[model samples]
Target: MKLTKTLTSLLLAGTMMLPGAAMAETTLNFVSWQVGEKGYGDWWNAVIAEFEATHPDVKIDFTLVPRDGYTDAMITQFAAGAPPDIVHLTSFEYQTFADNGWLEDLGPWIEKSGMDLDGWAGQGACVWKGTTNCIMLLYFGYIMAYNEQLLEEGGVAVPTTWDEYLAAARATTFDRDGDGIKDVYGTGVHLATANSSYTNDVLIYVLSAGGRWTNKDGQVTINTPETIEGINRWRTIVEEELTPMGMVGGDIDQLFMEGKVALRIQGPWINGFVQRAEPGIKEHLKYAASPLQPPLGGSSNVITLASETPQEKKELAWEFIQLATSQKFQELYSELGASPAPRPGAVNEAAFAAVPHMQLLIDATNAASAAGVDRIPTGLEAQNNEFAKVAAEEFQRMLIEKLPTEETAAAIQAEAEMLQ
Candidate 1:
């Protein structure tokens, strides 16, 4: 009777364990490239804390990879089948991952999340083909960083037209003290970092000149006359004493902060850095629209995001993203001087009113957002980077050395084809 009773208890215990006694824990690993202090990772940490507190059943492990060699680490992790549940995909690398089928489709999650992305351009950056592939969490517009004092000193009005922009660049440029050396430059070009975004920015010039980078059918259209015009206009900015070449690395931002350059095209983050890192620089800073149309004609803004992400995480990721970019968070970002998204009517009026010059940035982002156009699958972000380097360097040769326009255009077309 004792042995039978014990056997009965053991059988029951085994049955309970088979059904529900052993509960499994779901843990997610998130990897991002922003590892430095106050980087995106810092903000993500706060967001994760909130998520975990609300959902105690789930666990999240967040890791930030160094910005340098970030991609290599990601590939290694992926190869081992221990890829992080979530990864940060920048506009520069989105295509490569997506094309490889490494990402999960998040369309179902997006449909279920019921998040309102109407005002935000997040959808544009997150969508691939007809499917929504990624969730956009952050956005900032690229605009011309101008020197208010330099414009005032030169008696040059803020330029609105491309022609005027070129003239202003020339007027503001000079060897101020006549030391027989060019002490100041009117404008600057990014030659050092070799970032491919320059191609996108330069494409803005082509767009303003009424040129297209790709056809509606998805073909490269860079060799057209309008493109040639845009490229030539950029060259003039370099050779005609408007903007100078050789401003690479972070030199452009540094020079602009030091008031050596009158105008530069950069993001709002630089503005925030100036406010904290170099307080005096703030007094001279102002925001202006890109000369989309030649000396000053480009008037559009372009914002970029990455689309290669797994579907399962994209929704949750976007939730985190939405929280990060929500109007409330955007207001905080604006206060911190990080260029907030241009949701015009979406901005908090009271908060913006209290922050001086932030309104200008808001206005700039508005213009950029309105003018922002999406470039679909311009090739793998990696390929895009190479093409951009080729284009920027070619333009530099034309601007700095006055290389033949035809030759530069030809080279751009050739290299761009290789990317395709």
Candidate 2:
């Protein structure tokens, strides 16, 4: 009888320890498009490792989806009641997910957690319907990146105004070799169909011309005279062959890095590519504010509202979000040369001290208009995406087929009005 009681007691003790051990460990699923990219991937992995070190029981299961289908993938997963614990949301997708009731309202949590929002540069982009749904990770704005050596060789000064920009383009666009073909181009015009670059590139001109696609009342106003002038300016560039033909945003950046293009409008992230490609090339690369208004671009992180997630997992996921937006990670973001951190003080001063030119790019972030808000009203992601597709198609016709700008603008306005 004594031996039997002892064995039973020992078994019960072991059983009790099992639940305790299970309670100590948690695994969270984090989904983002940055997992495999160069600077972004490195920064994310480093932060994850640090978070795991402090919270020994938590494991982050990172899932990387390509940018092309990231939104659709998350939506599908959420519909099936198996969404990732954390989601990376772009400005265009934020309102759609929030309006669909697929994202957690993080206002109360942020208040409870004491996450400061005042210093973030693009904080306005993450709030919807008076609820804070996401937090800004990085704030990217459009800027002019030029090859200093090319400008110098062509005796062209960096353009400060629209007329100057056009003059510089004409001056620098010439055949370096007498091969009867132009070996270099002055700039690039992104006219690809069904792409955000087309919309953003157009926005730079539209906003610069004091024309906006939509007004404060959420109305579509694409056919205004200012907008017409903007489109005409872009058409002139195409007609004059100042920029390379059949090039998109990516092509512009690549050509700029290869020293084939004299100037291009790109985000701060391009500096990282320039630094990595050829260290000495940094001396030749320079950045300036766009000749007109700068378009805002970047993404935020949010927690998803999917079924079957344990409360502990939710808490752990929230902790990860807090850590990500913390000053330490923000500084890491700057140190890695990803983009300017959303928070004001997070741009690692020491790192920028070494590369002073980056401070100018960071300063340019102040000039950025709110990403989707400046272009369209809140809660119009689906409409905006559709409109972007139609607009890109029409704009391509204008650029490639030599269609009249007025005709193209009217067609674009018709499609946009359908959305309204």
Candidate 3:
């Protein structure tokens, strides 16, 4: 009996040492493209820490899938029915997952928790097939990052309209040190590609001119006069040789960071990149509202619970979602990411102190949300990638061929209609 008792005690001790004895550490597999990004990474780490604090037995295994690989990897995992417990999806691509019913219906949880989603930026995008499938995490309007030294030396006031902006670009596009080569340019654009890398840069032009890629009703409105006007505005800048055309978004960002470019219309990530600008450039970097009202940049990213998530992990995943979308984390997102949170009023004094132009981004997001504007077309939510690609390709063709704005708009309209 003594030997048996000793053996039992040893077994119990060994089991205790092996973990999952008193309380098994339930790990929620989480993956994201932002896990390693500078500001966004910090925000996510803090959120995970806060979640872990409340649920000591829970561990969030955060993994980084680089941006280029993110969408494909996510699609493969979800299609294989082994999606991460915590699914992080981009707004444009979330439709595919939601459409396939790979994401859980979050409505029951919201109702049970009495969560109020009113005026939530990008919330509308989460309503797919009459179910709230995801909680939107990020949305933004374009902000113009400018070089103060370049603007002042160009002898132009800050531009509040496209015309003035053109003037600024013209004045700033000159060679310094008389190198006889035009070394400095006014702007940079990702106009040589198809899809989001090029779409966003061109979309802003259309959206700012009181136009849209598609109306709220999902009609192809690109052929409208407003769209033509916006195209003209963009073309004018290009014709004047104001922008270093054919560069990708990253190259443009790098040029801005090096103080080689005067201005750039960018999303919230710009502030973070600017902070690391090459030596003399960081101090002179300033932000302003893009020339016109920034259209709702729409849902950039969202968090969702996988529909096939294990029953045991469902509540835990929801809890994590709740924590992520909580006001505290939203506020932290604004402060740490230097990006506006989808949650209104997230850009409070605390966030403003840490992030430059917090109020501008917040207010823009709020106004766009209030107006029910989203960069995604109303009818083509599920077909966003296709629609955006068509739009981008047509726009690139127009620029390369120097086609008239009318022709460009017509081409985009015809191609967009095919998607519908």
Best by TM-score: 3
For model 3, what is the alpha-carbon lDDT of residue 316? 90
With candidate 1 superimposed using the best TM-score fit, by how many Å does residue 128's alpha carbon deviate from the native?
A: 1.5
The candidate, 1 or 2, that scores higher on TM-score is 2
- Per-residue alpha-carbon lDDT of candidate 1 for residues 1-420, written as tens digits (9 for 90 to 100): 445737755765576678557433457677765543342344456667767776554577776775445656866766665666656666445545566566566666546756566765444655655555565544555567688888888889888777887878888988889888777788876555444545655665666676655655556677789878877776676566565555552566677777788887665555543543355766777776666532211112221222343544544555655565556655554444344543434446554664455565655545644554443323433365456667777776666676777778878777777787
Ranking by TM-score: 3, 2, 1
Put down candidate 2 lDDT per residue, 1-420, tens digits, no spaces: 445747755765576688553333567888887785566677789889988998876789998887666677877887788878776777666676777787787787888988888868667777788877777776666678898988988898999888888888887888989887886788887764466657767776776676667766666667889888887777777788888777766667777888888888777667655665465665688877767655444443433333346666777888888887788888887777546777777777765864556666665565554434244333345566667778888888776687888788889888787776
Candidate maximizing lDDT:
3
Q: In candidate 3, list every pair of residues with a backbone clash.
A: none
All candidates' TM-scores? 0.72, 0.84, 0.88
TM-score of 3: 0.88
RMSD of each: 7.7, 5.5, 4.7
Q: If ranked by lDDT, best first, what sequence of candidates would result?
A: 3, 2, 1
- Model 1 CA deviation exceeding 4 Å by range: 1-85, 116-119, 138-141, 176-180, 240-244, 293-346, 354-372, 375-383, 396-402
| TM-score of candidate 2 versus the correct structure, residues matched by position | 0.84
Candidate 3 structure quality by residue, lDDT tens digits, 1-420: 345747755766677887567644789999987876778888889989989998876899999897655777998998898999999888778888887888888898899988889979778778888888888888876678899999999998878888788888898998877978777888877765577667666667777687887887788788898878877777787777788767777777888888888988887887767978877788898988777565536678888889898977998988888888889988989899998788877777888899758877866666666656676777788887788778787777777787787987888788778877
